[model samples]
Target: MTEHGRPSAPSLFDHAVEEIRATEFRDDLVVREITAPAGVAPFSLAVAADIRPEVDGVDSPYGTGRFILLHDPDEPSAWGGPWRIVCFAQAPLEPEIGTDALLADVAWSWLVDALDSRAAAYHSASGTATKTLSKGFGSLAEEGDGAQIELRASWTPSGSLSPHIEAWAELVCMLGGLPPGSEGIAVLGSHRSTRG
Candidate 1:
């Protein structure tokens, strides 16, 4: 331990956290640090984000997501490196759009595209894209139907961490109905279900 007696954080982990804090997100996206999940690695950092668009002067969020950066000095075999990033992004979808057979594939593509576009590199990348549909019951029949898409992904990261976070933020915005490169524009209509 250092003379100060405080357990020193790994330099790589500290740098990663600093880079994440330095990254700038879209104006409409709200990001904040949250309790990182334990048992994933010796060091971890997590953040939560929401796409909050103004509707009639009220802030309405159409999507939300989480990003976690895990580091292990041992370089776990599955991770292929000391660093692994696990991300989750979910958003409500219009019933019609959700019914499309390609919806799940499209969601996965978005993640890949985001990473490629940012030039974030690594291997052992894997994840799942899930779509959930719900129909209101008797008492809530008037609420109609609803659908939501969720993507869970993890990958070892190489190079700077900035681009990775930015890409994930873009994915969150995309799933919220805002296309990439869209800034200062609010999404039209609400995907949020009246029931929930």
Candidate 2:
């Protein structure tokens, strides 16, 4: 116990890391924090990643997108919480999928299923899903002219967040938008598909 009375200067980032380690799924994902440098309170947050599947997979040119969670100390009017967990996923899609409503529905399921499967406690989730198609006319290299889908959501972590943390890690893996239970995760079994 230091002068701060609560403990030491472990910082929020350190706490988050310890939380990730104790959650039981940290090894399968890459966890890191992204600090927003221009904000008043220094909007620092962590992300646990599960890369997306590619055409060739092992040698695929681009990576599978991500399901990201964000935490902020400054309470926002909309989220109504000191910390908000945000989720998102972007993956190259066939041109035909650009207009399909299933994209949004499926993306939404990824989050919901993850939460339910992991029995995570959370509330007040809200956000949108967007389909983006690359467009440009320049010699500079750019993302291919393929379609991509992004799903965004924000929520507050409820008490005893161990379940929530496990769910979030699985959610990141799902956001890769690949068939779950592939490489390194098959042994864990596809928990999302077992909903009954």
Candidate 3:
């Protein structure tokens, strides 16, 4: 029973469904490919899912990507009956940027901005910031230091999966910092790198 008046993709149970936003997703994100289970942590969110979005970056040597849209159960004991929308973003690390805290701060903002930009209503928003730095060891040799950013988030959804997808789409854009989904990928020179 969402605003669109649809009965909701079968109530996260009746059958497998490809939940979607009015706007289509990027090729990098295969909608039907995502495979998640019913309920993640505790409250049994059952309607959980996942998707991936990628893009060319600016400062880093490599491109960028994000693991968008994960919904799960929040522990009843910890949060008092709330669902968690967990999200993760992975992007190329720019050389010597935001050494102290701005990076994490900006990262969190992406989630908030994503949610706000789409007008996705929800309650009790909270999440964690994680950045991993690991270089190839003796056996696992590599060219240079390996660095990546992971943004994990979970919140209680106020309504249906529609708003969630809208918010999730925004997060994908924020993580990759891509323009509106309408704009196609431009030439390297034309497309300024948004690597952060």
Candidate 4:
């Protein structure tokens, strides 16, 4: 080990971190470094991202997400590699759209599509998409119904790490209901068709 206890100076993990820092995301996305969860890997990094964070003390109505990169030189069997990327993204949705049976599948597909679009190579990907519906009760009855979609996924990543993070950021914005390449643009609303 090097003096720093790393296998070498500027280890692969360090390079990964640098790649993530240099990644470019949408102007509307606010990406901030956060504490990486301990005990998962010898080296790890994490970041939190929010779309349109806040304006005048009002929280963003878009969405929020987290990206975590873990590196274990041992090459964990499940990860299929020394590097693994885990992500979580959630967004509020129109109450009507939440009831759609295909929402979960579509949410998962978005993730795959984002990664493919960016040409990020990876394998051993697994994840789940969840939809939540809530209704106001009693004093809160006036609030009516609300819904949200959440996606959690992890995959072993190959090649340069920048594209993977970029894909993740894009996925977050997409879930927030923004079209591709929508940076710096104002969204009027999202339109969904009703099933009769």
Candidate 5:
């Protein structure tokens, strides 16, 4: 190599980065690259998105989320491969739904379903789904009560990342109450279950 005396050949990780950049997502989801966290891996990429319906005039988003890709060419033993995908999604929920004991389980299933629908191969998947209920008290009593569901997950991807990214985008849409491939059709309530 002319510079640094290192070979210039692109690595597999470089190709993965290109694939992620070229992938297209549904119009309802606004995605943009963000700074990835330090020390997670030798190579990393991060993206943040908001699930907002263009047809709807609502100023607030139904949900917001982040997707992070980490690659360790050394093949970290715990990752089972060179790549790992980390995801976090949060969406507002009706207070009653958030109080349901099954809410956490349902939220976790959404991610599993999203990856499966895309035929995204992965393993070592693990995560937690949390429901947060907020109630106004004291001087803030006028704000009323509200609730939300948050999903955090990490898994090792087995192949091309394009499908994985698309699946993640769909997961964000699903968390925001939009059905898979729905474009912009707004649903009355959360679409927390798999449609089959």
Candidate 6:
């Protein structure tokens, strides 16, 4: 314990933090570290990001999300290991796309596909994908209807945390309608574009 009387974070946890700090995400994402939730684990790190395409004159984001990493050296039974990753991703969807009945399943599949594509191994993984539809009320009827999709998931990490984090970032980009490897590619139909 230091002068503050709190137990110092473990060296392994420090290393994990360093790994996260060293990682670089896709250019389209605006990522920043945030305070982790207390009491969830002995050591935790969290990041939040917005999918901001660089289309000229566009200021709003396509979506936003958060990724949290939790580590407990004692190895929590429910997690199956010392490391756990929890993520939340939400994106506005085209009204038509939101009406699809398979949206939830598709969203969940995106996460699975992302992890598999990166070869990130894990178990005890579980999550929920939800689609929400909203219509303007009496005072706001001119606003029209809107829809969104949200994905909340957590999983155990079998090896290095970098891949898992990368996969999560990919999933966020996917939900935001940005195709994989879209870096440096101009986003068509962006607000700045006059194309119908």
lDDT of 6 by residue, 1-196 (tens): 5578755458778988888888899888877888899999999999887777345333235777889999997998999998899999878776767889999999999999999988999999999999887777788676677777899999998877788888888888888777787886765224321110
The per-model lDDT (C-alpha) reads 0.85, 0.53, 0.48, 0.83, 0.79, 0.81
lDDT of 3 by residue, 108-145 (tens): 88778777777777766777766655555576653345
TM agreement with the true structure for every prediction: 0.89, 0.62, 0.60, 0.88, 0.85, 0.86
Residue-wise C-alpha lDDT for candidate 5, range 1-196, written one tens digit per residue: 4387753334666778889999998887878888999999988999887776444332224777889999887788999988899998888877777799998898888888888988999999999988888887799776567788889999999977988888888777777787776886765464432110
lDDT of 6 at 173: 83
Candidate 5, lDDT over the whole model: 0.79
Clashes of each: 0, 1, 3, 0, 0, 0
Q: If ranked by TM-score, best first, what sequence of candidates would result?
A: 1, 4, 6, 5, 2, 3
TM-score of 2: 0.62
Alpha-carbon runs more than 4 Å astray in model 5: 1-10, 53-60, 187-196
lDDT of 1 by residue, 36-150 (tens): 9999899999998888744433224588889999999888999999899999998888887778899989998998999999899878999999988889989888779988888
Estimate the lDDT of model 1.
0.85
lDDT by residue for model 4 over 1-196, one digit each (tens)? 6877766523778888988999888788889898999999989999989888775233256877899999988889989889899999988887878899999999999899989988999999999999988887899776677788899999999999988898888888888888686777774243321111
Q: After superposition, how far is residue 50 of candidate 1 from its true place, in Å?
A: 0.2
Please state the error at residue 55 of candidate 5 in Å: 15
Model 4 Cα RMSD, Å?
4.3
